[model samples]
Target: MTTFVLFGGTGDLAKRKIIPALYSAFVNGRLDANFSFIGVAREALDDADFRQRVLASVSASIEGSSANGGGSTPATLQAFLALTSYCKIDAREAADFEPLKQRIDTSGANAALFYLATGPDLFIPVVQQLAAHELVGDNARVVLEKPLGRDAQSAREINAALRTYLKEKQIYRIDHYLGKEMVQNLLVLRFANSFLEPLWNRKWIQDVQISISEQVGVESRGDFYDHTGALRDMVQNHLLQLLSIVAMEPPVNANPDAIRDEKVKVLRGLHKFTPEEVSKHTVRGQYRAGAIDGKPVISYQAEPGVPAASRTETFVAIRAEIDNWRWAGVPFFLRTGKRMASRSAEITINFKPIPYSIFGTNQRNLRSNRLVISLQPEESVELFLKTKEPGEGIRLSDVALNLDFAEASTSRRVESYERLLLDAMHGDLTLFVRDDELGAAWDWIDPILSAWQGDSEGLKSYISGSWGPAAASYLLAQCGSAWGEEYVED
Candidate 1:
């Protein structure tokens, strides 16, 4: 049987995402009968208590949320609960793993998957304890959540420790953004479509803008967010991973390593920002008090658990360029922030305008043809093209060939956590980040971190409800391109 063990199983992540995902997978027939689950945490709960808790979580997740498709029947939910049990063990207590080992062995579970859903500090300790108890068998696969470490050196240490206990193939370092349907569609969108491959290079594409904005400020994670900042929290992993997918070469094969090999090359090819370049190319901002959706919100410094004098950035915008043949001249604008105008994740590929427009200067104001891929708030792809206005003398207008993924499919869409969990269970590492890829990403991010520390003037401030600091707009303006839908009003 395949046993799935969740460390930190009583935490917010487990309650909010992991459990709901697993139960959803079960409901959709993605999990077989032989599979079982064990929830590991220090919570003082027995089988009954934990099962009841699981029931509440599943109800709220599957039944209460429309996005999850309300697919759970009583019989299936009970069956899923039957497959789950709880184990109380403190990660620091080595002896606690002994009983957990016995429980797994007693269940006759031969293949096990351990998911470390805890903080980064507990990752090594939990793995070490599992190793000492002989719980990390060759058939066992381990999954790690992100913010693997603050920077490259720390990331290397964590990776080195995992290497001592597991093989590279056995480790699944997850970045949940990758498991999104549209993000994965990037692969098929480029490779399967013959028309796109010819235009995917620098000559046709002008600038690429990838931005992830949040309308909500750091709520309960203020302490963590204050320490990590936007650079490490978002840009280092999610934004960069997205950038790699948008800029990577066609892999030799669709195999996990083949796809990841191309991604690593993109990371390695990223132009390192010198201190001068960092000041010129990067903009970091903290949110000041403002309203979001007609409600007042506090500034980042005024948030609970954040320092009153903190210089931590709630927003960061970067103008990045890949030092590769296909993307050498193209600039990638990456931006992420908290308490922005809206919650969105979008990638906009702006194509160059026609060298010669026969329609005259009035039509010159018309934007160029470009592709817009929206990842959140909705999942859709829009290709903007210049079309003639019917009934007009000789007028041109912009029209979009839009494909909304959610509306296009009748079936329920799988959530990111569900997709990633299923992939881990099946040992498909294509959606997971490899060790080298993680290292290279951090290596590229570390210099920017250092530069930010030495320059106090680098941190700017913006109203909470605004897109970001004005400097962010200027970053893209310098290249003569705006973000996805921004306009210069009269």
Candidate 2:
């Protein structure tokens, strides 16, 4: 039995992801029987108003969810609603926190999970207020959402402030991407499969690519997007985190810290860039006016709150290498962008090609085997292998041995938020980011950022609704490879 306090209970994230996820967890019996929610905000909403907002968010999410409300009976919904309450307190005002403190004390919550869904600026104040009011429980936990900071120094400041009041064990820095079923499945695919582990090293692999593309522009987030470009916004956290998981050495145990320790080693293993290497290994592109599916879209410069003179990159392609025995000489290509040809987030492993084709040179265009873990418009894994084409002749063709998690399973796919949020409630930090991991990631990223700051090379341009600038492909071409386009959404 625990109490959940949502700091940004009425914000867009809560409305779209958090609230729906909590409700789904409740419906699935993933939550404790004595669990409840305390929706905290400065909205001046009473208990009833907050419950209604939760209902609306839940209803909207339900309509689109494959769970279709998850066997939630009216009585159960009401029971869940009855467990909820609200508090209207300006976190900036220390006095207002007293009321929240009193309410928590009265409720007798064994442990409380404080979720800071608000901006980075609010994290410190809220933690300070919670400490001052004596509302922070010995068994309490705090959940932090990203972007942790605008950059490394800011992230360090935030961590320092939080540490002043909360113990490291009590902090859970959540990254929803890690909560995805397929991402979690990566462990099983590698460790559990005896056939794949021996060939997991650079000796049997060529290069790896982690591509996360988007077909949509900044929309209303131009103000935020303008200040944070592709490298800082995406590559620093999401992309780096993915790379760590893919490249990390096997941990000693399944303990949360053990897994995290290995992950941080990967981040630290990332080859730091020099000023000159930064320019040669990285490509930054801004989207220009172009067509998507036959319709034209405005350039990133024309987006609301954007400056026409803005050189902020909407797209970034990076060639990263881990300086470790397992991955030495194996390049990890990381690229992500807005207003691209497809909406995809996938990590593709290109295995080294056969030294000699058994079927003779007649097998034209014989390609390397590829293991693609896609987490996008669809959740699936496909192993592209060369197969003998059924015929009287010795013809070979590539075939995908596919594992579509959605199609093969009858159980409802768990939402990323649902998995991570529930894990936070259960005090499971396996999927959350650690402070050292974050620091190491920033350490590796800061040099490139500094180089980009001083670069006169300027931004390359890619037309909207494309796979970014041709320069991204060129980054791979240098290594005798290319970006995988087969999985791009149509």
Candidate 3:
């Protein structure tokens, strides 16, 4: 039997994602009959109260999934709810862990998994209390939710503190993006296919564009977003993780460490930005008052809990280069922002143009071949190729070879959190971020943060429902490339 303990179990993260994911896993038969869940938080909720909350959360999740054609049975819901109980724990008080320990011990479970869905500030204290209570046994693993720290130094401190109570292998630092279906498919797409391997190089590839745009602003997280910003919030973990996967060399084997070893090399190979290059290669912007979907929205500063004079950036666009044999001069255009044109996350690999067009001198409008891997709104891979128009004088038109994952597979697609939770429960570390990987990411990010501090003029203002600041497009235009879909004429 394995006991799953959820810290900050009543918080927004637990309600919106953690608990719902756990229930989904259970409903999908991924969890065994011996499993149990304990929700730990400062909220004064008992077994009944917590069960009621879980019912509501699971109900809402099932409702949301119905929109996409899914549901659950009442019997299974009640069965899973029966295994759940809540315990209130004040992390600062060592005695608070006693109840949590007793609950787990009573279950006669040999292994346990602790998920800290709380703020980073409470990470060390909660782990310390668990260690002091002898709850972090050898079989017990701890799952940490991100924004690991504001920057490198603080991240190291938190990681070092975690090591004091747990071994390196026991810590699972999760970045949900890595658990996405297409993200994992990237491994197979690169290694399993023979056709793409030959063209996956700097010589054939012009520039790679990785963008994650959100249609909504910081709804209730104004305070957190103001302090964290897009660089630390999005770029540090999610975008860097994506970049590493897209740029990493084939691992020696399929082992977790083997894949991570190559990812670490990619991170280390990232070209460090100097103060001068920062101005030319990176663009930071804050969203001003604008309309999204024809609905008016507030600016970042005007958002509740955000400071009126805040200088935090809600958008970040960077032209990153990996200094390695495989990537070399090829630029990785990385962008992430809130209140953007639409909610989407994708990677577009633009292949270099033909040296000389044979169709005619008038073939200037012939677009080059490119591969697009869309991760959200839909999961699909599209290969754009220039073909001759029918009954025309070698007139070329762009056509796509699309492979939609949902249409191709009959299996039930696992959501990111659900998949990650199941992996953590079974002790699979491949999809989780390692400590050194986190450090290397922060190491590359720190210089940009420092550069932004000294140059206030670099922070541009962009309206909501836009791609980002005009400077973001210019950053790529300078390199003779553009973001996905922007290069096309509607």
Candidate 4:
């Protein structure tokens, strides 16, 4: 038997993501038959209440993804619930963990996986309590979620503290983005294909763009978002992790550390931004009152939990470069924002222009080749290639060769958390972040944080439903390129 313990089990993250993923894994028969899940939180709910809540979350999530899946039948759902139990413990009070220790001891499971969905502040205390109670051992593992810390030094401190109680192998720093289907397939797209590897460098590629846009505002996590903003909240982790996968060299082998070692090299190769570089190479914007699907929305400053004069940026666009030879002189544009045109997470590779174009007129708008890997809105990889317009004299137009993963697959796509959680249970660190890599990412991001903190440019106001501020476009214009939205490939 294997047991999974969830801290902060009834919270929003758990409800919206973790539980749904677990249920999907269950319905899909991904979990072991002897699996167990124990929900831990300060709430006074017993097993029945927590089970009902999990059922609700699973039901709601599955309803939203009707095209993809739903929960199992009543008997199956009840059987899954039977594996669930709840424990009430104030994480701050060490002695309160005795009950949790007893629960783990009495659990018939041969191994345990602790998932800390609680706030980062409680990470140390929770782990410390577990270690103190001797509740964790060689057979037990723990998964720590993101927003690890605000900056490099603090992240280091957290990493150090975690090391005191747990070995690096025992800790899984989960980045849901890494577990994304396309993101996971990225390594395959590069290493598995001989044709792509040679052109993956600066010689054939002009620039790369990674953008993650959100149509929704911070309605629920306003207080948390106001402090975090787009930089620490998105760029520091998700965007950078995506960048690493896009830029890393071919790993010698598929061993977890071997792949991560290559990834860390990409992180360390990031060209650290100077204050002037930060000013010129970066753009930040705050969403103002505007419409989405014609519905009105308030400005970031007017959002609840936000200061009236907040300088917090809800959008960020950066021109990042790797200092290594493979990518030198090639700029990787990273962008993300809230209250944007639509929700999409994608990585785009812009190839260099043709050395010679004999095609005329209608081809005036013809551009170089581009590869768009969409992570959301749909999972697809679209390659845009210039082709002669049929029934015409050498007329050229760009056509997309689309490979939509969802359309091509006979089976359901694995949810990020579902894949990641199972990896944690199996002690697979391939999809998880290594401790050192986290520090390297923060080290690259911290300078920008410092520069933004000291700068007085304030936040640029962008209308909601728009892509972002004009400056975001301007940042790209300086590099003689634009966002994927501005340049459409047929």
Candidate 5:
């Protein structure tokens, strides 16, 4: 039997994401009947009350599942509800782990996972308590959720603390983006298909664009978002990880280290940005009051609990490059923002335009061939290829060869957390980030953060529903490029 323990079981993350993911995994037969869920929180709720709370959450989240004929049957719900147990514990106190140890021993499951869904401040203390109580055994694994730290130094400190008790192999640093089906398929899209491998380098690829936009502002998380901003919250973990996948060389093998080794190389290859270069290549913005989909929205500063003079950037755009051979001179444009026109996460790899066109100037209007991998709203891969328009004219038009992941499969697409949770249970490290990977990412990103600390030169403002600030467009224009049209349409 496998036992899953959630350290912050009653919090929003555990209730809204963790429990629902577990339910999905349970429904799909990924979780066994002998499995147990021990939810630990400081709220002091009993097993029945915790179950009731979870049930209500599950009911609301799974309502959409029910609409699609995927709801849990009554018996299935009862059986799943049976596997759950609750315990109240102060994560910081070593003595409070007594109940957890007793429950694990009584449950008779050697495989255990401690999911630290709590705040970053509590992570080290909880681990210390688990170690003190001998609750961390050879078969135990600890899963960490992100915004790991504010910067490189803090991240290193957290890593050092965890290393005291857990080895690198026993730690799973979750980056939910890597668990997305389409994001994983990027590996297959690049490596599995021989057709794309030829053009996956700087010689044929002109530029790369990675965008993560949100339609909604910080409705409830304004307090948390006030301090973090766009770069640390999104770019550090999610966008950079995606960039690594797209730019990394072919790994020696599909093993965890093999994949991560290539990823680290990409991160290290990232061209170091000097203070002057930062001003030229980076653009930061805060969204002001405007309308999104005809609904009025508040600015970042206007959000509740946020100071009026906040300099926190709700949007970030950077034109970066890797100094290595495979990606040298090929610019990578990364952008992320809140209160954008639409919510989307995608990467577009634009191939260089055909040289010395034999078809003459008439066909020059055709868009460049692009391979877009979209991760959100829907998971899909689209190839934009130039084709002749249906007429006597020799004009060319770009058409997409699309693969809709959801429509092609009868099996339900699992949420990112669901796939990640199951991978954690099975001791799969492929999707989980390694310590050095995290370190390397922060090491490269810290300079950009430092450059923005006291300077306000390039910070611009954009309307809430806009694509981003005008400077983002200017950054790309200097490279004779532009943001992909997907952002502008919505």
Candidate 6:
């Protein structure tokens, strides 16, 4: 039986996502019955208290289960709660791990996963502490969450620190987005289906748009948000990883190295942005007070721990390019923001218009074909094709052929973290980002960060309930493009 140890187990991520995910997995019998979960935190809580917390957290959310077409029941909840236990230990001190070591030794499971859900700074120390207690065995795996570092050098430092205790294969660097059902489907949508492969290039794809927008500001994590900004927090990891998946060449096989090899190639092909080029390709914005669904909200500056003069961007938009044959001139537009008009995460692939319209003069300004993979606000894929307008004199209109994954899949849809955690247990590195990928991503993104600082591009302000700064629209307009349909709330 495999044992999972969660450091910082009483923290928000543990309570809200990790524990709940474990519960769901446990209830479904995906986790072995002999398995044990040992949560370690500074807080002194007994096993019963920890179980109650898990029960409370899991029961609060009404997540739709794809398996039953219903929510979790009290019986299922109780059964899952039985698998958990807690231990109190300070992650910083190696000596504090004695109790945790005793618990693991007693469990008698050689296969263990040491999940560091704490901040990045503590990652190394936690591993060292675990190593001191002999809790990190030869077969054990260590999982580290994102925001790996503030920049490339820092990331390397973290990697170097980890290497002192763990090997590259033993470390699982998770990017939860990769675990999402829709994200995994991206490969299937591109490679499995023959319809898209031939046209998946600069010759046929006019441009691609990747947007990850949030409707809420940094209500609680203002301090953390102030330092990281939109670029490092979202673009460097989440958005860039998505771009690689969208633009990468077909892997030799679906194996870990095969898939990651193609992704690395995509990252390497990224056209590095010069200072002047950065100015043209990027735009940063900070949200100002405005109404969201008729409710007045505070500006980013008003948030706790944020100074009035803070230049930290709440929004960012960039037009990136891959300098390879497959995607030479095609622009990949990436945008992410907080306090946007609506919450959405999607990728839109705009196919080039036909060589010459047969109904040329009459059918001017007709919409081109588009493939949209919506990751949130319900996961679905839509193919927007030009269709004949009914009762029209040779008119054409665009309509979507949509496929909703939630409605189609009969099996239970696993949460992103749930699938990823299981993968970590099974030692699957396919969905996790490797060091080379990380370095390449930072290499491509570093110049943009430097350009922003050198240019002193103060955060351009946009209304709270808006798409982003006007410049974002103009950035796309220069390429004769625009954001896909916005979700308007009633």
Model 6: per-residue Cα lDDT over 124-240, one tens digit each: 889888777777777899999888887889889999988888888899998989999999999998899997888999889999999999998988778888988999989999999
The lDDT leader among the candidates is 3
Q: Which sections of candidate 5 miss by over 4 Å?
A: 66-71, 486-490
Residue-wise lDDT of candidate 2 within 1-490, one digit each (tens)? 6889999899888988998888888888888888889999999899999999988888887788756387777887888889889999788998888878888888888999999998888999999999987767679999998888877898999999999999998999988889989888988787778898899999999999999999989988898789888887799888998998888878888899999999999999999999989988999999999988789999999999999889999999999999989999999999999999989999999999888767776556756899999988789999998777787877878899999998899888888999998898888999999999999988998998899999866579999988998888889999988898833321
State the TM-score for model 3.
Answer: 0.98
- For model 3, what is the C-alpha lDDT against the true structure? 0.91
TM-score of each: 0.97, 0.95, 0.98, 0.97, 0.96, 0.95
- Candidate 4, clashing residue pairs? none
Alpha-carbon RMSD to native, per candidate: 1.4, 2.3, 1.3, 1.5, 2.0, 2.5
In terms of lDDT, model 4 sits at 0.89
- TM-score quality measure for candidate 5: 0.96
Measured by TM-score, how close is model 4 to the native structure? Answer: 0.97
Candidates in descending lDDT order: 3, 1, 4, 2, 5, 6
Compared to the true structure, candidate 1 yields what TM-score?
Answer: 0.97
Instruction: Using TM-score as the measure, name the better of candidate 2 and candidate 4.
Output: 4
Worst 10 residues of 2 by lDDT: 481-490
Q: Where in model 4 is the C-alpha error above 4 Å?
A: 67-71, 360-362, 488-490
Error of 1 at 373 (Å): 0.8
Model 1 agreement with the true structure over 441-488: per-residue lDDT tens digits: 998999999999999887999998999988988998888988865864
Q: For candidate 5, lDDT tens digit of each residue in 183-284?
A: 888998888998888888989999999999999887777778888899988999999999999999999889989999999899889998998899899999
Highest-TM-score candidate: 3
- For residue 32, model 5's alpha carbon misses the true position, in angstroms, by 2.6
In order, the Cα lDDT scores of the candidates are 0.91, 0.89, 0.91, 0.89, 0.88, 0.87
